[model samples]
Target chain A: MFEGYTLAELGSIFAMQGFAGLILFSVFVLMALGLAIIFGQMGVINMAHGEFMILGAYITYFTSNFFLNYLPALFSVYFFVAMILAFVGAGALGMLVEWGMIRHLYRRPLDTLLATWGLSLMLQQFYRSVFGAREVGVELPQWLIGSLPVTDVIEVPINGLFVMALTLLITVAVAVLMYRSRWGKQVRAVMQNRVMAGAVGIDTEKVDRYTFGIGCGIAGVAGSAFTMVGSTGPTSGQLYIVDTFLVVVFGGAQSLLGTIASAFVISQAQSTMEFFLSGSMAKVLTLLAVVGILMLRPQGLFVLKVRR
Target chain B: MRSGNIFLKRNEVVFVVILSALLLVVFPMALDSFRLNLVGKYLTYAFVALGLVLCWGNAGILSLGQGIFFGLGGYGMAMFLKLEASSPEHTAIQSTPGIPDFMDWNQITELPAFWLPFHSLTLTIVAILVVPAVFAWIIGVAMFKRRVGGVYFAIITQAIAAILTILIVGQQGYTGGINGITDLRTLKGWDIRTDFAKEVLYFVNVALLLGCLLLAQFVRRSKYGRILVAIRDKEDRVRFSGYDVSNFKIFIFCFASVLAAIGGAMFTLQVGFMSPSFVGIVPSIEMVIYCAVGGRLSLFGAVYGTLFVNYAKTIFSESFPELWLFAMGALFIGVVMAFPNGLAGLWQAYAQPWFDRIGQRGAPRPISPAPISPTAAPAERRT
Candidate 1:
């Protein structure tokens, strides 16, 4: 595949593709982080995770328009505000879903997949009906626009850099929130043994509702970041669901570090291969490799050794 | 009066009689050919739903990628039909006279090596059945032997569906891409496009469905069936009791794939085309919903559920296209949350007790032959 390129050209090519892969990896981490939390921690399959992310995207879209219309002077800074609102909006909805739907399905993990799938469909239709079916892209502020020319062959887009920074910041925050905080401990305790946690006077239901909400909030933030790189459509969420699920599952559902690692590996492989193979073929090969590996290690890349 | 073999209980005999009459006699006499054909299309999905009843509901293997098998079977049949339809004389104007139109359009002068076996009808039929079974067996062994199941199995199967769809749609030159295999004219020179042929095909579809239904019923009744139920509830216990639990799961998964393939082949014959659209995640999940709505545990309910949901989809999508998805979505949530067992469960819970009471009143003796346990009685009466 590298037969025709000079060493310098190949170096630049890898550099450029690797940067592109980082943007994709950022999005995957954002999506898969929330999923790993819900699925790994709670043992619930949220098939509507993608839709929750889209809710964040739509929230960002509206925030941008709102800023452009009502607060013209602050239009450039609307993204931060949009991200916050997206988190709240998606988080609230996620809590509502947990309370209304997911709580009833704690015993039946498989049915949650179906129910959430139905939720995803309804959410897609809701997006289509409200936002129209055409793909929507948020306007970028002047600072976030344009690219930096690192070399004659390698140019890095500013928005991609911003999204990557945002991903890193959020990932660190989530890691801290999951690992160090008192609430995090309570949540982990609930997940480890619900009855024992309740016996210790921890309110398991409240922890569940909040955990689901926070996961969804992070997905919302991810969706907000997604607008920086690509167009969002009503059906865009469905496209990412399988890939994100693969990332989480491949990373060992219980480990936060595993999710990030799997996402990086998958996105890098896919984008680098895209430079050589057709885009769909690259995706096929990447997913096939992941699935093959998963077959061998069904517990995923990392396993949490916990007694039943 | 209990039958000696226990193949069909007293009420089960009546249920079978009524269901057969409805499919074979009432439907044909009542509906026009187009409507009947639509029902036939719905019935094709019933094969998939029936398979789900056994695989998912009984054995607790919920494969979201049944569409892969369906597509394999449909495409297998479609390849044969396409080759027959694209005979050299019919495509004399094209650059490649003997190849499928899509291939000729893509500048290929010859058929691919994989397309060679599909040239013969017998080979096509065999491929349709065996390919999906082999594929399912591979997936089942790889996953089940590792004890990877539940949501994990469902997700993996869904990923497989996504992969297959991408492969089919991506390889347009060989697989007909997104437009899929179309313009299928005849099957062994029978002119399948004709009205008479369509009517015959509907009958053929019904016969195949009925045959599959009986086979599924047999599996559900056999000792293996009880073991499957046992495995579903407590797989480790079954394994510790000296059963190769994975083998039972693999067998049922393979069995389900074969049933789905049969439906796919019949769908190609009746619908006259095959596409990646039906082989994707969305359609595969929708097929599960059909099984769910009908009552996953009940074979007859699966058939009825397929018909009911498809019928509503057609009617609702045609009239209020926007609302169809909402209705379908509600159906999924409603079916799962409110009534996990589905329409049959509703019937059993609400209606059967009333019928039993009326029957008891009609009988002079207070059910003296056998004191029916309320819990076990309804289940046995249905099948």
Candidate 2:
């Protein structure tokens, strides 16, 4: 189909597709990081992880509305504040869930899956009742609303760039918190061996709560960022959950680095295929590829060296 | 003396058979059609729960894609019903010719080739069992052979169900998208709208439920059931002892899929419609909860769990629809925390003591501790 295209045209198309893949990768990483921590660290399958992201998106929506309606002059800078508020809102809900429901079901991982799933459905319906089932369009600041021109033929979406920057910052912050901070050390200890960590006087319960909160908070950030690229509806989270899980599982659930790499691979594959085929066909092909790969390497692309 | 013991066993079966007959024969007469239909739906759920008990409780595979199987069976029946309803011979005088209304809206000139076989009842029934079995077999071979178990397996199965639902919804022409297959009428020459047909369907569902329960019981008491439980508790040990663990997993997984398919078929028959909503990630998870809350280790748990959850769903939706999910969430949390064995576990824990004291003469044999913790044991097994 593109046999007659010039070299420069092909290069531009490739660059644009690459850029789209990077944007998608960032989103996937942001969403899956939280899930990986909850699932890999605590061994609790929080099926409501997507719902938590939706909670964040909803927070961003309301925050933007507040800025627009009550403080019109500050609208230009509302994105930063909205993102923070989203983090807190989603983080707080995560904490509440941990305290109220998840903490009790730690021993029964499978049961937690069902409980969180029910929680997701309930939250989705609640959002529908409160916000209406129609997709809500969040008003982005003028600075983040459009594309940035890279060349005569190639323009990169500012929102995509913004998401990439945000993902980078969050990734660095999480890396520092996990490796350099006391709480991170404690979380690692708990994840590695809870009994030993508890014996060593680490308050494992507190670490669990904070770890879960941070994971949820990151998911919220992802959701806030998603508003730029996708519609926000009561059930919008469902669209991302499968891909998010795919990224986490295929990347190897134990390592953040694996998540990033897997996200890059899957998103690039998907974006490239999407360029050549219909959207649904691209998704099916990507899923089939992931399933095929996972069948070969059940522990995913990376396996942490830990005793089973 | 062995013959006497056998007679006592047969007596227990006889009692159960008599009780089921009484319930099936009398319950519909006593209740309104709506309630009767509700009970019939519960029976269908019970069958699905039985499949869970086998796959999850016994085989130690936490399948989250049974909803897909259930959906396949449902759509299969729905296809036949839609065909039968839309046939020129049975079409209402006011109804449009050929295409169903949804198809007309979607501008479908002809039915898809895959849907052609659903015009026959026998084909539909065969497809219900075969479709899910084939799907499960392929997935099982890929996953179980690769040694994916525990959380990874659960997530993958869930992803399959989620993706399947999305695919179904996206295919607006054949699957009716999100709105699903609705406005279903007569079933195989029977007027579904009439109370007589509803009563007959109810009886059919009841018979199917009883038959399924018996089948599950038989499976559980067989040597194969013991091997399944052993596989759940210790896969490597069984493999080392010369058993092909993968084959066992595949067998049980296929069996569960068939059972789920049957349940799905019956459920659609009673409900008179099918939709993408009926089989999705959420419903799949709900099926697991039904098994969990009933106590996966117990046969009665499956039956009771489905009944209890479905009943709660009906009551809560009517009374406080908004709070229903929250309530269910709370219930799940509470059950996992306080009642690990589920409502059935609670019943057995408290009520079994009394029953044991009244019926047994000697002291109960000491229960041997299994090699792994019951809850954790299932996940440890590879195959």
Candidate 3:
């Protein structure tokens, strides 16, 4: 397949696809982080996680429009503001869902999957009604556009770089918050033993609500980042839901670091294969590989041994 | 005393009779040919629901990839139909004279290796039944043997569905791609597009569905069925009690997949075509909702639930398209949250008691003498 391409051209092509894969990796990491927290820590399969991210995407779209019309001078900086709003908007809705639906379903994890799937459907319809059926893309500021010429053959898109940077920042923030913060400790405690955590006066319910909220907040931020690389639609979230779930499940649901690593591996494999195969074929192959590996190692890439 | 029929209780026999009457006589007599054909299409989905009733509700394995089996079966039948439809004279205008139109469109002159066996009707029928069962067995063995159940199993099955959809859509030459295998005209020289053919197919579909329903009912009544329920509730206990839990799960999963595949083949025969749209995540999950709404545990309820939900969907989507989704979403939430048992549970709880009172005045009690002890009776016969 590479018989005609020069060695340098092949090198640059690999470099280009690798960078593209990094962008996908960034998106995967952002989406899977939220899922790991909810599915891993809480044992709640929020099928609506993608919808929540789409909600953030829609929120960002609205924010960008608002900034463009009312505060054009501050438009370049609007992304940061939009990201924050997306987080809060998605987080509040997440908490609301948790209180209303998920709390009752913690005992029946499978039922939670079904119920949230219903929630996702409603949310998709809600987005369609509000935003129209067509996809909406956010306009990037002058600063986030264009490409940086790393070499004659390898030019990296600035938006891709910015999204990667944002992903790294958010991943670090989530890691620190999950490990170093007092709330993170409580969340982990509640996850480990609800009865014991409650007996120790840890406010397990509060932790659960907040944990769910934070996870959703991250999904919203993912949606915000997603607007950089691609357009957003009501059903676009559905496209990512299965892939994001696989990433989390493949990473070993409980491990945040594992999520990042698995996301990188999957995204790279997919992006690199896309160059050689049709897009659908690449996706089919990637997913087939993931499912096969999962069948062999159901605990995923990273295992945190704990007694059931 | 035990019932005259070993498989069915007395009330169940009546239930079966009424259901058969509804499908076989009442529907055919009442509805127009087009509408009857539409009902036949919906009944194909009931095969999936019936399968779910056993594997998911009874055995406690929720496979979100039933669409794969359905699509496989549909495509298997479709291959044969497409081959027949694409006889050399039918496509003399195309670059390729004897191959499927899609294959000619893709510039392929010869048939693919896999498409060869589908040329023979016997092999096609055999393939439709055996292929899905093999696929399901592979998945069941891979997951159940590894002790992967609940959400992981659901996610993996869903992923498989997604993969199959992508594969089908990607290999357009082989699988007919996203548009799917269409323009299917006949089944063994019978013009299936005709009204008369549709009516015949509808009866055939109903007959097959009743057969599957009875088969499912027998499985639910057997000792294996009891063990399946036990595995659902306390898998480890069943495992410790010298039962091979994985094998039980594999059997039910394979059973469900075959049921779904049978539905799929019938669907192709009735609908005149099959598409990837029906082989994807959305359709697969919607099939689950059909089973859920019917009362996942009740086989008869699954059939009714499928009919009812599909009816509502058609009516709602036609009249108020936007509201259809909201209604479906609410149905899922309501069924899961408020009434976990679905329509059957509602009937059993509220309506059956009243009917039983009327029946008791006119006839003797319907249930057999408590064979396993009165206290264990409720648990034993929950399905």
Q: Please tell me how candidate 3 rates in CAPRI terms.
A: medium
Worst lDDT 10-window in candidate 2 chain A = A276-285
TM-score of 1: 0.97
Docking class of 2: acceptable
Chain A TM-score vs. truth, each candidate = 0.99, 0.96, 0.99
Candidate 3, A56-108: lDDT as tens digits: 99999999999999999999999999999999999999999999999887887
- Tell me the deviation in Å of residue B199 in model 1: 0.6
Candidate numbers, best DockQ first, in rank order: 3, 1, 2
Q: Which portions of model 3 miss their true places by more than 4 Å?
A: B364-383
Better of 1 and 3 by DockQ: 3
Per-candidate DockQ versus the true complex? 0.57, 0.40, 0.64
Worst 10 residues of 1 chain A by lDDT: A104-113
Q: Write model 2 residue lDDT over A33-122, tens digit each, in one string.
A: 888888777887887888888888888888889999999999998878988988898899999989988887777677677778767877
User: TM-score: which is higher, 2 or 3?
Assistant: 3
- lDDT, model 2, position B117: 92
Alpha-carbon RMSD to native, per candidate: 2.3, 4.5, 2.2
State the C-alpha lDDT per candidate.
0.92, 0.80, 0.92
Tens-digit lDDT track of model 1 for B1-383: 44564655566667678888999999999999899989999999999999999998888889999999989989999999999999999999999898999999888888999999988999999999999999999999999999999889999999999999998888889999999999999999999888889999999999899888988888888899989988987887899999999999999999999999999999999999999999999999999999999888888889999999999999998899998888888899999999888887887788777888888889988875432311132331111
Residue-level lDDT tens digits of model 2 in B1-383: 26543322443455456648655777776889988888888778777788888888888788988898889888888888887777655444423556555666787777678879988888888898799899899989998887777678888887788778877887777888888887778777777867777788888877777777777767766778778888877788898999988888888888888888888888888888889886887788788888888888756667778888988999999998877877787776666666767765676567645755654545376433321223232232332
